[model samples]
Structures are given as structure tokens and as C-alpha cells.
Target chain A: MARARSEERRAEIVRAALEVIAERGYRGASLGAVAERVGLTQQGLLHYFPTKEALLVAVLEERDRWDTSGGRDRERWRLDLMESLVEYNAMRPGIVQTFSALLGESVTEDHPARAFFTERYTQVRENMAEVLRAEFGDELPGGLTPERVAPLLTAVMDGLQYQWLLDPDAVDMGASFRDFLALLREDSKRSA
Target chain B: MARARSEERRAEIVRAALEVIAERGYRGASLGAVAERVGLTQQGLLHYFPTKEALLVAVLEERDRWDTSGGRDRERWRLDLMESLVEYNAMRPGIVQTFSALLGESVTEDHPARAFFTERYTQVRENMAEVLRAEFGDELPGGLTPERVAPLLTAVMDGLQYQWLLDPDAVDMGASFRDFLALLREDSKRSA
Candidate 1:
């Protein structure tokens, strides 16, 4: 029972940290503010997360956990499933905003989150390549290998997010993604 | 003579501000730090630009100036020219980093740079549409209008920048952009 309570408390603290970071950005968020949000003294918060950096890592991990839930098979991800993922993201603006903020900051050399995002992209590209290879053998219809196209796939997803976040009403990220997918399908048809 | 010298000093300050902002991100950058980089007191920097927001606007405008110089005709911009622009950007990492950082921050509702980027993208999309119409016609190869494809064009450019900045060794942003262009060309040929 004590262990379960501790786990719940840690999850609650991570949620509060996400809210604070989303509103003020990572650089602007403080441990004190997150502690207040969770009804803990700063010292109590530190007990849960030994430092601000630890709290940040915890928040990022929690976000990944939420995204990869439902035991969705990664190797079977298709265009429709990718669109569904984009739709799912549309429902969670706070999480997306927090992610964008950290991603933007992580480009700098010294950011604590830099290593996390770097590894994440490397993995994301590899996973995307695997999905493409499974769907299309060695070469996609455009004669490009999955390895060649994986970066573009990741680019479109992230790029669409930036535009959508800036002007959500104007940018239909899901539709735009579907359109790109259609282009890929069209290429396959022409080549075949 | 004094007026010319003052203009030169203003330009120099803008350059320094870009460096500081790129290194520290917008939230972490301070006017005092920027001033110190350019050998000015904070008061002296304020004398030139009364506020940090004003300085930020100046930095953004200066970047645009650098990008659009050389009198390359905008209405006549073709795929080849667009590719050239991407190549040019690869040569200037500092400027690209500053622009990316501001763009990421401006996604937040209240950032001072928000209006500038929003307006810039709106104009950019329109310009891209014009370029496509000139190069292709009423319809691109895939049957979508140029207006429909403009945002994706912009998205790919910005997205490639993010990935390239994160891992320059692994990502060739220019080559990836060219590959996207090739896909568009293939679409055109099939439609033809």
C-alpha cells in the first residue's frame, strides 16, 4: 500500500510539472512552482525528484508512456494509424506545447533535455524506417529506401506540429499529413 | 557621418543579439548579456532600442534582410532557387538557430515575436503559391492547387532545419529537401 501511494504521488507531481512547464516553458518553470501546484513544500518535492533535471526527465518519460499506451504494435503502424495519432495529439494541446518548448530549447548545446530528444529522434527515425520497410519491401514507390525517407517522415510530423501550434485554426495538421501520405501512395502507383 | 556610424552600430548590436539568443534561447537571453557582447552598457543598448522586444524585432528583420538580399526575384522563384536557398541556409547555422528558437517560442500565445512570424508565414505561403503557379500552372501534378501545397513546402523547410540542427552529421537537410522536390516532380510527370 505504501509503495502504491508513493507511485501515485510521483505521477501527480509529474502531471503538475507538465502543467507548469507548459505554461512558462522549461527555463521559466521552477521547482517551487511545481511543488506549490502539487501541495508540497519544495523540500518535499525534492524528496520525490532529487532535482529539477530529474523532474524534467520524469515528465518526458511520462509523456512517452501516455503516447505509447494501448500496447499498439509499432511494426504494424500504417498511414491510418499515423493519422489517428495526429488526431489524438490534437486533443492534448498542453502536452504538445510542453514538448514543443523542450524540443526548441534542446537545440542548444547545454540544455539538460538535449540528450533525451536526440536519442528520441534517432529511435523515432529507426522505428519509422522499420514501419516503412514492413509496408514496402526494400524500396518505396519513389525508388527511395525506407532509410532515405524516414527523416522526411519525422520532419513532416514535427513540422506540421509547429504550424498547427502557431495557428491551429488555420493549419489542419491531420489533413495535411494525409495529403502527404496520398502523395507517397501516388508515387507507389506510378512506379508500379 | 555620425548618422552612418550609428546605423552601423545598430546593425552590429542586432548581430550580437542573435548570437546571445541563439546560445541561451529567448527566455534565457538578457539585454545586459547582449549589451556586454557588443561592448555596450545596458543603458547604451536601451538608448538604441528601448526594450528587449524591440531588439528582438530588429534581429528578426535583420535575418530577413540577409535572406532576401541579392535581389533574387521572388515571383520567379523556382525549385532550383528554393534548393539554393536551403543550401545557403546550411552555411549560416547561427542565423538559422536564432530563427528556429524564436519560431519555437513564438508558438506560445503571448511571445513578443509571435505576430512577426505569423505574418511572415502567411506571406511566405502566398509567395510559395505564386511560385508554384508560375512553375506548374493551375494544378500541381497531384491535382492539388498551389495554395494547398504552400504550407507543406514551408513545413518541410522548417522541419528539416530542426532535424539538421539536432544532428548535423546524420541529417543532410539540403539533400532531403531536394528529394522532396523530386517527389513533387514525379507527381507532376504522372499528371502530365
Candidate 2:
């Protein structure tokens, strides 16, 4: 019961932090605002989070948990399912904004989240390569290696997000992503 | 001569602001830090830029001016020239980091730069579509309209930068972009 209660409190705190960050941005957000939402003093929050950077880290990890924690098979997403992931992302603009905001901010000089993103991209690339390998074998029909193609796949998904966020009505994130998948298939027709 | 001197002073301040934003990030960057870099008091800097938001807008516009302000025809870039542009971007990681960092942060709530990026992307997409229409004529071999494909081209460029920033050595930005260019051509081959 004690352990479960601690986990629940942590979850509430993370949710509160996300709301604050989403509203005020990471730089504008205050630990006080987050703690207040959860009915704790800033010092009390620090007992759990230790530092502002630690809280940021926890928020990012929790986001990934929400994204990938759907179930066991969710981790091993296929190409088609990846398209669905994009579709799912379209439904939740607020969450997508927060995640993208974090990603964009974290890439700069000595950001606490920079290392986290670097490692995540590394793993994401490796996982994408495996997905390509399983579906298309060692090399795609056009003789491109799975390792080589994985990054492009990742890039399109990310690139479309920026465009979609800027103008959702103009750029249908899911349809555009499907179009990209169609383009990917165009290569095989020529090679075959 | 006095007007020219003032223009030069503004340029110097903008450059200083860029360096500070790059090093400290946009969120962490301050007018005081920027002023200190260019030998101005905070009050003096305010005389030039009435607000921090104005300074940020000036920084972003300066970046575009550096990119597209090369002359008259620089604005009307062709598809092949775009490849050169990508190559050019690869050589300037600091500028790219600053631009991307701002872009990511601006996507969230009430960022001063959000409207700037939204308008810029609107212009960028329309420009990209024109480039595609000129080269491929309405649509490429895949029958995908230029309007539909414009976002993908932009997405590829933006997406690749994030990957390259995270791990430059592991991902050769230029070569991968060339590969994407090659993929774009694959569709034409089938249609032709």
C-alpha cells in the first residue's frame, strides 16, 4: 500500500508538471506552480524530484511511458503500426506540443535533456532498422540497407510533426505520413 | 553615413545575440547577456530593441536574410539548388542549432516566435511547391501534387537535422539528404 501510494503521488506530480510546462514553457514554468497543483510545498516536491533537471527528466520519461507503454507488442511496432502512431499523435495536439517543445529545447548547449534525446534517437534508429529488416530483409528492393533507410523513416515522421504543428489544416499529419509510405513503396516498383 | 553606422551597430548586436542564444539557448538567453557581449548596457540595448521579443524576431529575420538575402535569384531556388542549400546548412551547425532550438520551443503555448515560424513555413511551403511545379510540372510521376509533396521535402530536411545534431558522426547529413533526393527521383523513373 505504501509503495503504491508513492507511485500514485509521483504520477500526479508528473502530470502537474506537464501541465505547467505546456502552459508556461519549460523556462517560464516554476517548481512552485507544479508543487502547488499537487498540494505540496516546493521543498516537499524536491524531496521526490531532487532537482529541476530531475523533474524534467522524469517528465520526458513519463511521456515515453505514455507513448510506448500501451502494451508488450507496442514496443515492437511494424511499419503500418508506425503510421497508426502518427494518426494517434494527430488526435492529441496538446501532448504532441509538449513533447515537441521539450525535444526542440533539449537539443541546445548543455541542456539537461540533451543526453536523454541523444540516447533515445540512438535506440530509435536501431529499433527502426530491425523493423525494416523484418519486413524487407537485409536490403530494401532498391538495394538500400535497412540501417540506411531507418533514419529517413524517422525523419519523415518528425519532419511532418513540425509542419503539422505549424499548420494542421494544411498538413494532414496522418495522410502525409501515408503518402510518405507510398513514396517508400515507389522504389520497389522500379527495382522489381 | 549616420544611418549606415546605425545599421552596422544593429548587425553587431544581432550577431552577439545569436552567439548567446546558441550557447545558453533561447529560453536561458537574456537581453543583459546579449548586451554585455556587444559592449552595451541593458538600457542601451533596449534603445535598439524595445523588447526581448523584438530582438528575437530580429535574430530570426537576420538568419533568413543570411540565407535568402544573397540577392534577387537566391529567393527563386530550384530543386538542385536546394541540394546545395542543404549542403550549405551542414557546414553551419551553430546557426542550425539556434534556429531549430527556437523552432521546437515556439510550437508550444504563447511563444513569441510561434507566429514568426508559422508565417515563415507558410511562405516556405508555397516556395517549395513552386520549385516542385517547375521541375516536375504539377505533379511528379507518382501523380502526387506539388502541394502534397512540398511538406515532405521540408520535413526531410528538418528531420535529418535533428538526427545529425544528436549524432553527427553516425549520420552524414549531406549523404543522407542526397539519398532522399535520389529517392525522389525513383518515382520519376517509374513514371517515365
Candidate 3:
């Protein structure tokens, strides 16, 4: 019963964190404010998650937790899964705004989330390379090595987010992403 | 004497605003804190700029004020000029951090700069389409119209910035961007 109650409480806190991040962005969000929203003191919140970063990770993880498919093998992030996530973000305007704001916030100096994102990108880059290598062997179409194309994949994903967030009607992430993927495969059929 | 004094005072305030933004980011920065830095109250700060957003615009304008070439025609943002700006940003990590932070904060709801960035991107898309049309004619090298390719141009530039800012050592913005440009011209030679 205690375990169930704790799980329930954690869920509530994650919801509040999402709202807080949506309101003030990840950098602007504070553990105290989130705690207050959940009827817990800062100390009480700390009991659940040791630091703001931990809580933020929980909130971020929660975003992916309920998705169609995430963390399938932990290390190997499939391309289709990424496409689905982009589609999911398109449906959720609030989450798109919140995550975009968080990425923007993390680029600054000494931001609490700065380290988190920098490390996240590094990991993302490697995972992308791994995924590309797995699917395309050593090289993708046009002799573009997996290592060379990994950053472009992530860049297109994130860059499209900024544009989509600014104007949804003008740029469609799902469609635009498919077009990009098509560009990569433009030479693949010729080679095959 | 009064004109000179006011100009000098504005310069001081812009400098202070830069420091504040570096420390606190654009959203976290307060006009009051900025005024206090230059030994003035909020009212005095308002007298100079009227609103926080206006001050921020002024501060942002100040960033481009001393650039080698900006606002050449006010409406036309040249591709090479943008490339130069990327190189310049690499030289100034402080400026990159501040601007990247600003963009992040602007994507959220009701942020003072949110409207500005939204409008800016709308304008950027148009400008890019115009630039692409001017260089590539109505149809680009691979049957991709400027209208279709405009977002990709902006996407790659902005996306690379995110990657570059996250890890400078691994990604070279200047080199990577030129490569992207090369990819665009890939089909031009064949058609010609």
C-alpha cells in the first residue's frame, strides 16, 4: 500500500512539473514551486527526487514513458520511433513549447539543465550514429558515413522543432521529416 | 553635451544588459536589475527605452551594430553574411550563449520576446525563400522549389547552431554549413 501511494504521489509531482515547465520553462521552473503545487514542501519533494535535475529527468522521462515506443533497447534508437515522436510532439503543442524552451534554456551558462542537455546531445549523437550504422551498414547513401550523417539527423529533428513551434501551419514536422529521410535515400536506390 | 552623455549612457546600459543576460538569460533578466547595474532606478531605465522588450531590442541591435555587415538593405539578409555571422558567433562564445538562451526563452507562452521571435522567423522564411529564388531560379537543382527548400535552409542553420553550442570541439559550424551549401549545389553541375 505504501508503494502504491508513493507511486501515486510521484505521478502527481510529474504532472505538476510538466505544468510548471510549460508555464515558466525548465530553467524557470523551481522545485519549490512544483512542490507547492503538489502540496508538498521543498524538503518533502527532495525525499522523492534528490535534486531539481532528478525531478526534471523524471518529468522528461514521463513524457516518453507513455509514448508508443521508447527505450526499446536503451541504446539503439530506431528511426521510425523518432518519426513517431515527432508526430507525437506535433499533436501536443504544450509539450513542444515546453521542450523547445527547455533546450533553449539549457544552452546558457551555469543553467541547472545545461549539463543535462549537453550530455544528452552527446549521447544522442552517438545513438544516432549507432542506429545509422545498424540500418545502413558503414555508409548511408552517397557514401555519407553514419558518423557524418548522425549530427544532421539530430539537427533536422531539433531545427524543425523551432520552426514548428513558431508556426505550425507553415512547417509540418512529420511531413518535412519524411522528405528529409527521402533525401537521404535519394541515392540509395541507385546504389542498390 | 547632453546628446553625447545620453549616447554614452545607453552604451553603458547595453554593456550591463549583456552581462546580465549572460548571467541570467534574457527571460531571467530584469529591467530593474539592469538599471541597478548602471546605477539607475526602473523609471530612469524606462525613460531611456520605454519597455523591457524595447531595451532588449536595443541590446540585440547593439549586437549587430558593430558587425562587419548587417542591415545592408534591412530586408535582404545575404547568405554569405549569415555565414560570416556564424563564424563570428564561434569567436564569441558569450554572445552565442546569450542569443541561444534568448531563442529558447522566446518559444514559450507570453514571453516578452516570443512575439518578436515568431515574427522574426516568419520574416526569415520569406527572406530565405527570396534568397533561394534569386540564386536557384524558381526551381532549385533537384526540382525542390525555394518554397520547399526555404525551411531546410533555415533548419540547417539553426540546427547546426544548437549542435555547435552544445559541443564546439566536435562540430565546426562554419565548415558544416559550407558542406550543407555544397549539398545544395550538387545537382547544379549535372544539369548545366
Work out the TM-score per prediction: 0.86, 0.86, 0.79
Interface RMSD of every predicted model, in angstroms: 2.6, 2.5, 2.9
- Residues B127-160 of candidate 3 have per-residue lDDT tens digits of 7888777777887544567777777777877777
List, for all models, the DockQ compared with the true complex.
Answer: 0.44, 0.53, 0.42
The C-alpha local distance difference test score for the whole of candidate 2 amounts to 0.79
lDDT of 2 by residue, A1-192 (tens): 999999899989999988887676656557888899999999999988887767877887887766666535744568887888899989777667766766787777777778888888898888888888877778663456888888888888888898788788878999988877776676555557
Off by over 4 Å in 2: A1-8, A15-30, A51-53, A70-76, A141-143, A188-192, B1-8, B16-30, B36-38, B51-53, B70-76, B190-192
What tier of docking accuracy does candidate 3 attain?
acceptable
Residues A1-192 of candidate 1 have per-residue lDDT tens digits of 999999999999999998887677655668999999999999999989987867877898888767666526764466567788888888767667667766776776577877887888888888788877877678664567888788888888888888888788888888888777766676556567
- RMSD to the true structure for each prediction, in A, is 3.4, 3.3, 4.3
Classify candidate 2 by CAPRI docking class: medium
Best of the candidates, lDDT? 2
Per-residue alpha-carbon lDDT of model 2 for B21-118, expressed as tens digits?
Answer: 76766666689999999999999999889878778788889987766664357445787777887898887777677777778977866778889989
Q: Chain A in model 2: its TM-score?
A: 0.81
How far does residue B97 in candidate 1 sit from its true spot (Å)?
1.5
Give the C-alpha lDDT of model 3.
0.74
Candidate 1 runs further than 4 Å off: A1-8, A18-30, A50-57, A70-72, A189-192, B1-9, B16-30, B33-39, B50-53, B70-72, B189-192
lDDT of the candidates, in the order given: 0.79, 0.79, 0.74
